[model samples]
Every structure is written in structure tokens, then in C-alpha cells.
Target: MAAYVIAYDVGTTGIKTCLIEVSGTIKLIASATEHYELHVLENGGVEQDPEDWWHAMSVTTKRVLERSGLPASSIQGISFCAQMQGLVLVDRHGVPVRRAMSYMDHRARLELKEGIANGIQIAGANVFKLLKSLAITGAVASSVKDPVWKYKWVERNEPAIFSKVYKWLDVKEYLICQCTGEFVMTQDSAFAALLYDTRKGKECFSESVCTMYGVDMTHLPRIVRSTDMVGRLTANAAAYLHLQEGTPVFGGGGDVSLIGVGAGAVEPGSTHIYSGTSGWVSTVVSRQLVDASAMIAAIVGANAGTYNYFAELETAGKCLEWVKDHLALDEINIYLEKKHVSEAYESPYESLYDYMMDAIKNVPAGSNGVIFTPWLHGNRSPFEDANARGMFFNIGLDTGKTEMIHAVLEGICYHLRWHLEAQEKKVNTSRVIRFVGGGALAPLTCQILSDILGREVETVENPHNVGAVGAAIVAAVGLGWLGKVDDAKQLIQASARYMPNMANKAVHDRNFKVFKALYKNNKKDFLLLNAGR
Candidate 1:
């Protein structure tokens, strides 16, 4: 009988569990999903009950184990990958003191601003402090506020909870504690939390930084590497998940790092692009590279042995879904029917995208002097400004619906290109791009990306499940079934490749300049627009 490993991916929207064979083949097992609402309060506050996450993870793991029919002993180990930067506080007895704040939550904006005003420098070094200051001032919302501020917010607003809390952690650490009854943190996660010293690869928490915000480092968990087994499943947790007591549980990193490993982008200079509800561009870096201006830094990778540099476009598939629902509901079947058809040629009754692509093909690349900024959900990385809104420039009567649609697609591609360029400048490497997620299935979009970036983009066979698979790989390593993460990369198979169309390179290059200028010209306008709110 073959042994199997269970991996859980705790996402922002839901939780997914997978049972995989030691050889890296996924078995058809049960999975569970639960949705939690993002409670939005006044003044940009967002919170969710931490219990909701626990419930989702527990039920989902049990469901998968029951469906697999493997005896508890046959399961070698368990691992987890979670959304990064969300904060959870647990009291001394291990009960959540208050609702956990989601990464999207901006409730602590004022607190962060005040911290900067009072000269509360985070991470000490001038560069890190500047980044933190930028974040507090709302210059870059998502990039600036991390779990640290959330912890500080709890300290100030819920002093009772703060006094009672014994351990403060990201969502992954909190869930793992529930499983193993151990208090620990992963290096990759800690580094991304902006609470650890990334330069020395040490678990040094800044006392000055914490003191400035009235936070005590004693509440933080002991830091561990991503590959280390932090603890074992306790009898209680075993009863809850149908797993054997003492099953080893490994410390895991954030989702972005795991996603890179799952997509077979473990090697340095290899890039992975995932488009789920949101989109991300991640590449493996051997060293921590910091860019003061771009807001790009090296964070934890799938394992402690490497670093992962990530940039994000806040909305990707979400925008597409919005378009599908609002503008192309009646054309769903038509679009699906033309999946494999080349949209290069114009036909009188071509598919919706075909018409759109043709309309833009003649628009002299770059949407014919038009630029669209994709800040629909607010910018995530590179430019972390949440107040930024999407815009279209160089539009005229000649710009029809198809042209507008094409411009939107081009705008997204250009945003990604901007990140890739910035990353290359910081790291000085030419990496092949691996495109994954639901968006990768769109050949036209993939080709457009290739044309814009002047690089080949390959699609993985199982983009949607890569994160789950990567989590399983961690479990396999913990079980000693795999020697290293790279060994598990053999499991990933490329389904298709999108090579750049050189013919359109010059066209895209010329338009890229205008696309690049849109932000500079409209930055003040966006800030002014947000002031009205």
C-alpha cells in the first residue's frame, strides 16, 4: 500500500485539503470549502472571526481524510500554507481574544499614521523604516501595514485582550497551534510579517520598533524554519481530524512562496504568475533584494533555503469575472466555443474576444495611445496605494467597445510588465515566466503577455491546484519521502507554452511608454478623487 501525505492550503476566501501519494500524484479524495464574510466597519475596518478559519481547516481536513480511506497510520505527515500578513491573537489558554484582521483590512490606518508621526520606526534600518512610514501615510496601503500594526492595534484598542494574549501570530501559526498545541513561527512567514531581521537571517525582533507601538515581543512565537517539524498532532486534534495522534506537522511559509514551488519555479530567476481572485508575480531569489523606491523586497520562499520576491496586481480574474457578469453574460458560450481558435484574423462574426483583439490589433499597439491602470481592487505591490483607481487615457470616439475591452487586457498585461521590469532591475536576472491559475487558460491573454514582455510564458497543467500541491510537497519532505523541494518539482508538467510574437514587440514597446506615463500624469488626480471620500 502506498503512503499518502495530507496538505492544507488556508486561503483568504476558503480552505483546501489534498491527499497526495508519496510519488506526488494526487488521489481523488474529499475536499471541503467554507466561505467567511469580510466584515467591513466604518473607517475602512475589516475583520473576521478567527474561529471561522479554524472551523474551515478542521472540517476540510477531516473531509479529505475520510474520503481518502487511508488509515490514520498511512498518512505520513501534514503541512500547511496560508495567506500571509493576516494577524491573529490567542489568549494564554489559546482562545482568540478578538476578531482577526484580514490583510485587506485598513482599520489600523490611523494607528499606523500616528505611529509614524511619533517616530516609531519599524524594522530599524532606515530603508525599512521609510517603507513603513510610506505605508502608514497611505502612500502604499497594502505593502505598508502588516501583522505588526494589527498586533499594535490590538494592544491599544483591546488592552484586556492584549494582557490576556500569550501568543501573537499569523493565521498559519494560529491554526498550527490548534493542531499541535505548540507555539511556533516560520522564518519565511516571520520575515514577510516585517517583524524579523531579514538581512542576517536571524529571528531578531526589533525592541525599539515594538516599544514605539506599545507592543511586547514576549507575545510572539518562537521562530522556526519552513522545513522544520514544529510539533505533532495532539490527541484532541487527532480526534477532530481523524488523524493519528503524534502525526508530524511541519512549519510552512506563505501562499506565494508555496505557489512558486508548486508551479515548479523553485530555481533562482524562475518566475511564477498565478491569477486566482487576484494575480501575483513571484520569482525565486537566493538573496534578499531590497528596492527602496519600488516597494519590492525578498520574502520567505517555500523553504527557508531560498527567498521569494513577489509583486502583485490586485485584480486579475476578478476583473475578468466582473466583465463576464456585466458585459458578456450572453456571450459565455460563444467565448468558450472559440477557446482554441486563433483570434489573429478578423471575421465579420468572430468571437467576442476575437473581435476585441482585432479591434486592438489595428489600434497601433498600446491600445492606440491609450493606457488603462488596473487599480480596481487597489494596487497591492510595487505601488501599494489603495486609493488608486483604474483609468483610461487617450480615449476618443474612435475607441469602440472592442478597443476599450482590448485596452483593459493590455492594461493588466502592462502592469505585470512593469513589475517584471522592476524585479529584473533589482535582481539583474533574466528568468522564464511560468503562468498559472485560471487566467492562464486564456491563450489570447497569455500571448498578449508574451508579446508585451517579449518573453515566453508557459502554462502549468494544474494552475488552480498548485498551491495545494506545494503544501503536499512540504508534507512529503517532512515524511522523508522527498529529499528536497526541487526533487518534488518533477511532478509539475507544463501543459502549454506561449511564445512571444516578435512581430508585435515593437508595437507593444511603443505603447508601453504611454502606458507607463498614465500613472505619473494622473497620480494627483487619483489622490484628489480619494479625498472626496
Candidate 2:
């Protein structure tokens, strides 16, 4: 009876599918989520099986469609937004070569260091190479997470696997190829390669830049705009998704840009903070920018002729998950004892956050002088360092478990403030920021971020689904359901705002000073400090 679009978001931890109806007012009909595993190696290698992502997409789509009770033909289009910077290599037959290298993977740090050692030209490239790259792409990351670096790593480390590669693709491109048999990537996804000619204001893979990254240009996929029709649904994919054959599919982009739109950050300089498995502070802008010193960059946005300035802190909501997995289990027994339920066997994993929050909610803002550093796998934003380790500093005899847990929460906000400092230089992020992500669901986190930023942090009714909503909005615009790029912002209504609590300002101010000093003072030869590091 009404028109609908299926928006699927493939995030670091999971795949979330949303069936959204656009009949005068945009409304979510049904939603489903499926999580996969991240294979973390001791040597800083991080990967995920592509097949697992496909399987999750298959199941989640079918389930969401079933719950919506809409006919397959009624769904007008399907679009996607996926985690950025991941490498998903496929062969001539479109089969994944091996486990995909996640954005979190830093196995190519050796390559990054070698490039930096060459000179101050590009910091990671020679003067000529740096000028050419900056002229075209605006930003270039020589880190292991760059798709180009992943290719170089494969060529050097796994020659056999590298030889079979037919194309170098990121998560969004791989998923698009999987759906329609179209070996193409959107400009937003192509931005991840740091090999695109962005200065042209036209989307195309740059051969010269690819050569600079030591990657073969022939292995790259074709580029398209985010709103362009990649292709119709293939019969097999449609069947698996329980949707009509030949359903329109738009060329969706990376999560960073899509989330900016979904969070109503379509206006230039409209800022938002995202926290899922990985996190960042981003703002939509009309102009191109690059700051090599601070490691922040502005690439093309999900919408045409716009850009998004993204500064990542690497970890946000992930810190919460880490605490849950490692520390919350012990709190379960404490909860049992406090409640006098005699359920000693109770697993803390089952309400991990609630238990931790119960303790954290009661603790003071300063965590009673306890401090936690969130560099659990190192940091990538405001600065780049791979040898840094997560630390628990300022712990004293009086510090309790609750104080330690509260410090972890505070520690995440502290890093976010540091990220904001860099973002403010390029964009005015001093105003209210839209906080959208899985992390925004936690009231404590919202309040902490607001207090730390000294501004308003707002969340919508469906904070976690904003990425999927943004993808759907892209399709909706292409389908003529929406008039302009900014019109889609109305779909998400901000229902709550967390204002700064001045009561904790003085304490946080003192702690923020120490937070910066902790990183500065602990600067050491990490290789020598921990040989296994």
C-alpha cells in the first residue's frame, strides 16, 4: 500500500537492516540486526570473513522483510552504508580471496614507518608524490588501514593470495558487487583508497596515485556517485532477500558520510559524534580540506558536491564492550551478593552494561582520581601511534571497582575532547552536536560527552539505525521521494538532549590536564618496553 526502501548498514561488529516507509512521513517499519566476529591476532592483525557478512546480510534482510509484511514489489529500492577503509579482495570470479582485512588492522605499520622515514615531503611519501597525491585526493593515509597499503602488504607478505586478486575493494564495494554482480564502488568508498582524483570534482580512479601507493590501477573497481543506480537486484540475491527481482539499487557510500546525513548533519559544519565498534567526530562541509599534521581529512560526502571532515579516535563504544567482556563478569557475583539472590552462577555477560552502569552511575565524576587510557590497539586520530597501550593511571588505595569502571567511561570522553580540538580548527563544532550511534543509547555516555564538550549532545529515537536510515535516504532521494539533499533530515527527530553538568566541570578540568600529560609523559620506546608489542 505504501512505498518502502531497504537500508542495510554493515558495521564493524554487525549488519543492521532497516525497512523504512516513505509515505509523506518517513517511518521505520521493521528492523533486524546480526553480529559477526572480529578475528584479532596477537600481532595486531584484524580480519573478518566476508562470507560471514554475506550470510548475515542474507538472514537479516529476509527477516526484516517478513516482519514488515510488505509485498516484495512494494519495496522500491535497496541501498547500503558500510564500515569504511576495510579491504575485501575478490578474484576473477568475484569470490573473496581470503578473510577481509578490517580498518583496525595495522599489520602494515612497517610500510608506514618506511614511508615516513623517506622525508618530510608527504610524511609518508616523497615531495613529488606528496604534492601529486594532495592535489588529487586532498588526504593520504599511509597507514595499514588504507586499502592501498593492504594491497602492498599482501603483495609482500602473501604473494600467492596477491596473485589471484582481480579487484581491490572495500566493504561497501564488495557488498554492492555481491548484490548486483556489478564490480563498482561509490566515490565515498573510493575515498578510502586515497587513490582517487578528488580535485577533478569528478569521481574516477587515479592511475598515477595508485602507482604511488605501489598498487596496480587495473585491480581497482569503477567509481560511481552514491545516488547512481549501480544495478537492479540479481535474481539469486532477490530470492535470498525475499524481494522482487530487479529492485532498484543505488550506489550507496561509506558509513562515515552516510551517518553524517542520517544524523541531520547535512548542513555545512553540522557536527556529530559516532561510536560503534569504532568511533569518530565528523562534520559535513562544502569545501575540500586536508591537515596532514593533525591527521584529519575531508573527503567527498555521501551527497554530491559536498564533503565530510572526519577525525577518528579509533575506539569509543568499544571501550564499553571491552569492560563488559573483561570486568563485568566479576561484578555479576557482587550483584548477586548485594541482591541476596544466591545466584552465584549468574553470568555477568547477560546485562553487562546494566551492571557496570549501576556501579558507574553511583560513582563521582572524577572516578575518585582513577584514570584510564583508551589506546587498546593504539589510536589513529588527533595523532597516530601504534605502540601506545591502554593504561590505568592514577589508581590509588581508595579507588574501587566502581571508580575504575567510571574512569573508563570518562577516559573515552577525554579522548573525544582531544579529537574535538582538532576538528574545531577546521570546523565550528562548538555548537550542539548530534550524537548518533550504538553508544548514544547509554545516558551516562551522552551526559559525559556533553559535559566534556561543554555543549548539548542530542540523540534521536533510533540512534543505532541512523546509518541504515542515511542509506535509505540516499535511495529515497534518487527515487524522487525527497526533493533536496537536506530534506531527508526531517525523518530523524531528535527526541532527547543531554546538557552539560557544571557540577563536575572543575574535577573534569583537572583530570583533562592529567589525561593529556599521561600520553605525553608515557612516550617511550614501546618496542623495547614490550618485546612482544
Candidate 3:
């Protein structure tokens, strides 16, 4: 008797869907995750087949609908969240001409520079700077360069695909078209593409820029807000997915902004730290706070009703995975088995983490004058240098596994602090830090963040799936089941909060000073290392 809303998250790895009641409770659903190979032909090229995403979506949506056992008419609305900056070109018949270059694809770096030299502004424009800088510096050669540059590349190199293309869109927009026969993009997703003017909230396809590059503005999808219902499900799509015709589909925002809503960061000054593959410090802001020098600004969200001001430190949980794979596989397996019998595993592999933490706990506050830079894949926000490399400095003969481990945690904390300080300068709001993602499960890491930030960090249960849940929240609101976004977030409850330890804070302060110096002292060296490469 109760109506339900369906939410789909088209992520970098796969498609995830959730069926939820109007009251924000998740019901039965299904997901289909497909892994695609990244093709790197040379130093700076990455590409993936667009059909992969489409196939994944079609299979996953059908699975969710079947698993729920609810008729298509019972579903009131649908919403989505997806990876940002991917470029997909579809012909006039709405078929893809080439593989969709994902956000991780970086082949267009030279093309990005060419656009910049021709009076095109690339930096401070979304993912362009990060991707291009990575390729130019030889830090990463697999990023997709800038979307604008990729657009140009297709125009010049594959004119047949370029000329026949009717819609050039990100993954989310492409999915919407596949579902409802509509070509539309949400403002937030567009903002991250660096193709939209965040200042004016307008699509900025310069006639001159397009003319010079042989790109037609007509190929771009019409922009809409996150909450806006772009279209209804077509009969063909409905039949394929076992859904009712005319089911309303709402335009969703990028993954990060949607995660903000999922984590309940809906109000100004409210901040959260997400530790997935990477880490970030983000706060909600009311206006566009542009930082020309620091690569900081207000990114548009699902709707113009809110803005997200944030900075990222490229690697967080990713580093831990690297360690697990390379350094402590045997120890991890032993700990996991021991954890199954006793309450010791209640922390879910915390014993192993604690063991690692203990090894480094005694190592002096600054890891005995050692510092680790967490730029393994290149610097992301705050410093947009892609040529940046991770380093361990000031290591002595006395340095051991414990010291290196401690230094890794300390370095990640310091990078997070850098972003938080920058965000504090622009937004003024009173809210505790909510920590989510795999890193939040580790008390040692959470406590370190709390001590460094000098604030209470609360960990939410099921942090991994918050993004999918947030998409469900949007679906609920769009269907008139929820009064507002804030009401929807209430469904999320924190499992525990970590308060700062003053003693640890004092210790971290000295190490943080050293960590800061490491960057200033070695930045030139990092740049020089990439020279002429």
C-alpha cells in the first residue's frame, strides 16, 4: 500500500540501486557492479567503452526491480548520482561513437594546454587542472585530461564522431537519456566539468571557443537542477526494466555533493570528512566563494538551493589498502581469524590496525624527525600539482616499520588539516565533523583526525553506502513524500563520536609544523624531478 522511490548511483566501479519507503527507510533492492579495464596506450592516454556503463545500468535496474517484487506503478520517482568529468559522445541516433573517457583517463593533457594557450581558461575550472597537471608532470598518465580538451580532441582527431554527435554528456546525463529519452544535465555535475560558469550558474560554451575548435554548442545537453524532474520513463525503457511508463526521473548531482546530503551536511558551516579511496574536508556554503590562488570555490550541487565548498587530499583509505597488499597480508589474515571468536573483532579488524598503531605509538610524535608526503598519485585540491609524488623524508637508520606507519597516519592527518583551515576561512557555521567511509571504522585514524582538528568527529554507521542512501533521499523529496532536504537527513544517525585528546593534540602540533615544512622544502625538488619528462 505504501509507495517507494528508487535511487541509482552510477559510480566509477559499477551501478548501485536502492528501494526506499517515503520515510527514508531502505527496502529490498539489487545492484550490478561491472569492472572495466582501463586502456593506457602511452604516457597520457586512458579510455573505456561507454556501452559498459549502459549495459551495467540496464542489468542493475532490472535486477533491483525484480528483487523488490513491487509493481512499476508503486515506484513514484527515480534519482541518480555519478562520477564527475567523464566525457561521452553520442551520435544523432543516440548511440555512442567511441569509448567514454572516464575521470581517471588522462590522455588529453597536451590538448588541455593547447586550449589554455588559445585563451581558454583550464585551471580553477573543475577536473581539468587536476587531470592535466598529473599528465604534464608525469605523476599520472592515465587521467582523461580536461573534458573541454577531450571535446576538442574528438573534434580534431575523430571528426566523423564529432560531426554526427548530437549530445555530449557526462555519465549521469547519458544514463538519464537512456532511461527516459531526455538529454539533460544537472547543474552540480556540470560545475565539476569546468565547462559551466559557477559564478553566474550558466553554461559557458563560448561561440568563439567552439568555432575555433569545430565544436557545436548544440551537442551539449540542457542544464537543470538536481531536484528537477527531467523526464518520465519511456515505454521501451519501462518494459526493459519492468517499470511503469511515465515514472518521474529527477536529475541528480555529482557523487561528492550527494554524499554531503547523505551525510547530513545540508546547512551552512556544516562540514564532513569522507575517507573512501581518497579523503576530503568539505563544508556547505551559501555563496560562491571563489579562491583564484588556492583552487577553492563553491561547486554547484543538485540544485541552486545549496553549494559545496571543499578540498581534497588525494589518498586516504587507498594508502591503507596499499599497505595491506604489500606489507601485512599475513598479519591481517591472522588477526581477522582471531577477531571472529572474541569481542576483539567487534572493531572489525581494529586489532590489526591497533597492532600497527601500537608499533608506531611509541615512535616519537614526528616519527623521529621523519615525514611522509601522501601524494602518491599527485596532489589534488589546495595544490593542483599532478607531478607531485609521495615521499618519506628525514628517515634515519633508527627508523623502523613502526615509525613509517606512524608517519603515514600523521601525514594524512596533516593534509586533511590543510584543507580544513582553508575551508574555515570562507564559511562560518557551527557543526561537528562527521567522519564517514572505511577510514571512519578505524578508531585510531578517527582519533588522530579529531586531535588534529581539535573538534569532535562523529562516525556514522554504514558510512560506505551513504551516497546511495542520499540518492534515495532525493527521490523521496522529489515525490513530495519528504518536506525538505533537512527532513530527509534525519534518517541518518551517528554511531559514535570521537573527541580530541588534548595531549595528543599537543604532540601532533609539533609534528604538523614539520609536516608543513616538508612540502615547502621539497616542492621544488618534486617539480624538478618531472622536468623534461
Error of 1 at 493 (Å): 3.6
User: Which candidate has the top score in lDDT?
Assistant: 2
Look at candidate 2 and tell me the lDDT of residue 422: 85
Each prediction's Cα RMSD?
5.9, 2.9, 5.9
The residue-by-residue lDDT of candidate 3 on 1-533, one tens digit each, is: 45677777776556677666655444435444455455544444457677777677667767776777777788888888777778888876667888887665545556655554334344443344434432222111122244767777777788787777888888888878888888887877666655554434334433433444345678877888777788999998787767789999888777777888877777777788888767888788776665534555577665346677767776776676566555554443434443354455325535555555644556655667677778766666677765677788878888766677777877888888888877767676345898886678777788888888888998876676667667777766676776677764576777789888888788778877777777677778877885323
The local lDDT score (0 to 100) that residue 442 gets in candidate 2 is 81
Ranking by TM-score: 2, 1, 3
TM-score of each model, in listed order: 0.83, 0.94, 0.81
Where is model 1 poorest over a 10-residue stretch in terms of lDDT? 133-142
Taking the candidates one at a time, how many backbone clashes does each contain?
Answer: 0, 0, 7
Compared with the true structure, what per-residue lDDT tens digits does model 1 show for residues 84-172?
77878887767788888877665565566665433544332244555653333212222435666677777788788677888887888
After aligning candidate 3 to the native by TM-score, how far in Å is the CA of 343 from where it should be? Answer: 18
How does each model score on lDDT?
0.70, 0.81, 0.68
